[model samples]
Target: MAEKLGTKLNFVQKDLIKKSTKEPGRVFTVKEVANSYGISENTARA
Candidate 1:
């Protein structure tokens, strides 16, 4: 989705997104990832 939207994601964002997909334990939203990682929502979305 980021590729289609042309958003450049950093390593951390990429890792977060990857884990979110593969975990299958709990779903992560932008807000959840941000809170978990202590990052801003914009960074999570990136």
Candidate 2:
């Protein structure tokens, strides 16, 4: 579905997943992700 629409995980999303995998027990909030990526909090939540 997303692929058909040409939608995919962005760099920030990929990096967040990689970091989480590399460090167990790590947690990230939508606000933190948004700040780190310079995106809006709502966008991070989505």
Candidate 3:
């Protein structure tokens, strides 16, 4: 369905968004990754 629309997103990207939108199990805290690795939150999320 997505491929028919000409979207460049692959299966993994689409799957992640669908799963997140459906349940959103965790808060998706980019800050956590940044703090753990000593990187900026924006970079971590990106």
Candidate 4:
């Protein structure tokens, strides 16, 4: 069996953080984030 290590933030989370920092004050909705990342709105909200 293999052991799995958890990460504090996945790629998407890290990317979101980077974007927010660079653009400061910009608001991101679940739908916008989902569309940008090509993920579902439900997943983005999660």
* lDDT tens per residue, model 3, 1-46: 3465327765544655776799867465677656755678886676
Candidate 4 Cα misplacement greater than 4 A, ranges? 1-6
Give the Å error, residue 2, model 2: 12
The reply for model 3, stretches above 4 Å from the true place, is: 1-6, 25-46
Which candidate number maximizes lDDT?
A: 4
lDDT of 4 by residue, 5-38 (tens): 3356778888988899999999999999999999
Residue 44's lDDT within candidate 4 is 98
TM-score of each: 0.48, 0.73, 0.39, 0.77
Q: Which ten residues in a row are the worst by lDDT in model 2?
A: 1-10
Q: What local distance difference test score does each model get? A: 0.74, 0.82, 0.63, 0.87
Per candidate, the number of residue pairs that clash is 0, 0, 0, 0
Model 1 agreement with the true structure over 1-46: per-residue lDDT tens digits: 2364225766666776688688877677889888888899997776
Order of models, best lDDT first: 4, 2, 1, 3
- Displacement of residue 9 (Cα, Å) in model 4 is 0.8
Using lDDT as the yardstick, the better of models 2 and 3 is 2
